[model samples]
Target: MMRPRRLPPCLAAAILTATAVAVLLLSASSPGGALLASRQSPPPPARPEWGPGRPPSFAYWISGTRNDSRRALRLLRAVYHPRNRYLLHLDAAADAAEREAMAEAVRGEPAWREFRNVDVVGEAYAVDRTGSSALAAALHGAAVLLKVGAHWDWLVTLSAADYPLVTQDDLLYAFSSVPRDLNFIDHTSDLGWKEHERFEKLIVDPSLYMDRNTEPFPGTGTRPMPDAFKIFTGSPWVILSRNFTEHCVYGLDNLPRKLLMYFANTAYSVEAYFQTLICNSSDFRNTTVNGDLRYFVWDDPPGLDPLVLNESHFQNMVNSSTAFARRFEEDAPVLKKIDDELLNGSSVQLVPGIWCSNLSKEQGRMDVESCLKWGDINTVRPGHSGEKLWRYISTISQTRGCS
Candidate 1:
């Protein structure tokens, strides 16, 4: 389930196609060229919550391409915590100017400067998610985070369409009780329809060698499925443990690297790589929880994309124990509701957490602009929803162990 982090396969293509038009207007767009003139902007003012790093952290890999910069920033605010590490990537399809703009926005944020945890990939390559390149992009991000050395316990992969369902405090609190080695991945050995459609086909990703992104091309013949390893498939989204991430990034054993080469020619290998590796490796296969920890609504035929969420899904979204939900429109009203009710976010400020040292009454709600002074980052105070998540994890975690 902890597949590579990249934009959706089809979406990346569409974004790359628009690069030509975007470049034409780059000079005229302030948002696109704003950061080019100034590269060393000061960091956000220091807040009390994270004065000198006293808490466990998360390393988030959030990626998008082209026009997705705005959505990426919004997601950053929603999940931003001084104690966590963030790496943002806009694929090669986007113009360098556009990527610079995104980085500029990050540089302008005082909070990011103070913590020095948020980073953007200055150089990127086209990543076609349908092929194995998506896995490459994800591994690249993990390697970058590992090099950053921020002491993160987990790696969470997310896209622009994804949104957090709980505050960072609630999420950290709920996960604190569970063992850090436990990876939440939903996997089944039964390949079902994908056996022939995905596993049997040999495809080549043009992004691997070409400067532009393109659809994968089918090879002449089909290959027999392998008995050397059992194939498992499930939701591509995953919450992976730090140790497993290291194994994938550094490849302590030959299996992880060997599987990467085998999957390079397989279609939609992102859906297969991690699933097969964990199930096939004795060291990690038993550490899985058999859940991706995400809430998604599938269509009847279950096409390539999940159903786009709207207002009607609001109640269900909040009620779910999952930490995140997906396939939302860029500015869906449901997102506003999630911000208002769950995250306490607004147009100007992000979701407030225990790290926010001060709060004031404004418009009938609490306003937390910044951490300003100081607060304990190590401690977490879970909200009401955290209790439900705790019970669910405690109950299901016992029964599900990579079975």
Candidate 2:
């Protein structure tokens, strides 16, 4: 989001980090994790009871590079919910101390500690957005989420620059009714210009091999598009179903691995790999929803990146009613505005929701860092934004394109 723009694919991590995170799983070893790995519905994490139509929980893979720990933490707090699971990561460019600091901040929260739904990747390797390593990093994050906590329904990827436009409750409430098998990925069979620049561009991501001093753009070469399968490209950001992520990771079918090998040499593979895989796979093609549910303000000519949002974009952003927006400046006034105007909470404090019920009830509650007490996490009290988001998702879910 800052420099070396993040290739946002809602779920992912690094192989190097996988070796080190062997012991940091937030939830204890349980059969639920195994069930999730086997692509079945795992028992929900031990939390409060609820009535019918309980909202779906998300597994967020929030990644950042060097010097982004605070920003990542800020984003985590903004989206935190007892219902969801979080895996925070500072990539290889970031040092051990920064990773430790990020972990410490996550531990600083009482609700997170009580629920044990958050974790920080202790080890990392290079991740270059312009190369296939970006895709690798995302895959790694998905691997970790699948490994550690398997209770979440959907996998959401967030960069430090991204902030939620809708509160966690709103997003969850909206998604509560959607079919679990449906995947929300913006896609098009029309490659147009990307067919040459993206699919045909053969490149080597140095980060895949090295540990530091990542070269921004990898060297490139030209090759014809793959004849084996049709290629699809669209917004890198996606809200992937757990089954889809498992399909990507477990590789029960050879298509995922075949595409992985093919895209490993292609530049910005994160933008196309998932799209191509889902669209090509017979089982998942019809489940595609043709929208990523992210709000962005594009440049006049629409350059490689979206325009950096600021105060001027607030009303328009709210009008869009998307779940998240990207590329905000660190601690920008607009963030404060979103916290106050939209979220109905403080920028520094967790978004007020049913889960944080006891925080408001307690007398002289001094700890601002943690929600000392909690309420029924399964109970969802959706705000107006939540209702609008539900409608937005319902309308978009009817669109077609993955085939």
Candidate 3:
């Protein structure tokens, strides 16, 4: 693919630097240590392979707010791969200067240049997780990812606070044997305590129409919760299939459209929109596996946000068997541990994969032969933990989805 020059997302400013660019090219002795030398070496020539022969590719929509550009880049590198697609967005909360710098940084990466699969949204949109505006932003990202390419099978949404528990290779290998149509979203129809506060009550998100942030307003009147369609709600984080995403974005389904309008007046609609829409549509309900493929710890009573993960959460995070986890503090030391122990990633270099060949550890750079060459993009070679993930998925797969 011809490389496309685009701006970096809000969190990748250092990605634009020539020095930092070469730093990633160089190999490191340890994950957190200084770069040592180039370790790239030429390999015997072979004809390039493509399509199902390689690992499955993902389309990632990584979103964050102001002052989150660096953390976004770190997460990006942690999950980066040549075959997958990425779309980054910084909400209106970030100023124009931060947004532009992020875009420029993405353009500076050699691997991103060779594959041309990464992009940052230059335009700004208002978003507040406290209301429906966050869902609007997510859907907007899905629209942009669709416009970027047609090759990806799934769409995963992540925040700057989230980090991977496994490498791209580990994640791909674990998912390779599974059906592509299934979505990993934790959902439930049993609203429990949320029925009165979330379903019956109504609120307005001024971010939907206002140029600046405004608190949500309670509706003057309350409406009985609808039985027209079963209401479902879950974690906002999701790994959605491209087919289902298309259903939400372009399908001629009235339920999806109706739910969007209904949830516009609901608080924290990002958590409810897809859950309600997917379960209501008989076509998609069976396809749901009811897992978000992420690990998170909620405060008791479950406040507006989850606990911010730190070093103390490291061991549990690794043992969770989830692909990712969230609410991590920026530049947490635990992240460095993950890069070293799990992903085999360096401080700034992307998590290595089969796609990356000819790495040089001594000189700390990829030689002229270091450009990402194509391999079996659809196949996967799972690691030790990858097998465990497959087993966990199998168990989750057997349980009938939430009623």
Top model number, TM-score: 2
lDDT ranking, high to low: 2, 1, 3
Clash totals for all candidate models: 6, 7, 34
lDDT of 2 by residue, 1-403 (tens): 0111122222222332333334343231211222213233223345643334677889999989999998998888889888788888777889888887777666655556557778776666678777787788778778778776657789998899999999888998899888888898988889898888777767767777787636545445688778889999888888999988888777577788788778877878889988999999998888899888888889888988898999999998899979999889898999989988888666566887887754432247553444645666787788899999999999988775565
lDDT tens string, model 1, 1-403?
A: 1112332323222222222211111111123323334344333434424322333468898988778888888998889877788888878778888877877777665566556677777666778878877777777666667666347888998987898988888787777777778888888887788999888888988887666766789987898989888888887788888888877765567777678778888888878788888888888887889877788999998989899998899899878788899988888889888888887775456566666545322534755444444355567778887777777777667755454
TM-score for each predicted model, relative to the true structure? 0.85, 0.87, 0.84
lDDT of 2 at 1: 9
Candidate 3, residues 67-128, lDDT tens digits: the string is 99898888888888766788787777888898777766665555665456777776676777
TM-score of 2: 0.87
lDDT values of the candidates? 0.72, 0.76, 0.72
Each model's RMSD to truth, in Å? Answer: 7.5, 7.7, 8.2
Query: TM-score for model 1?
Result: 0.85
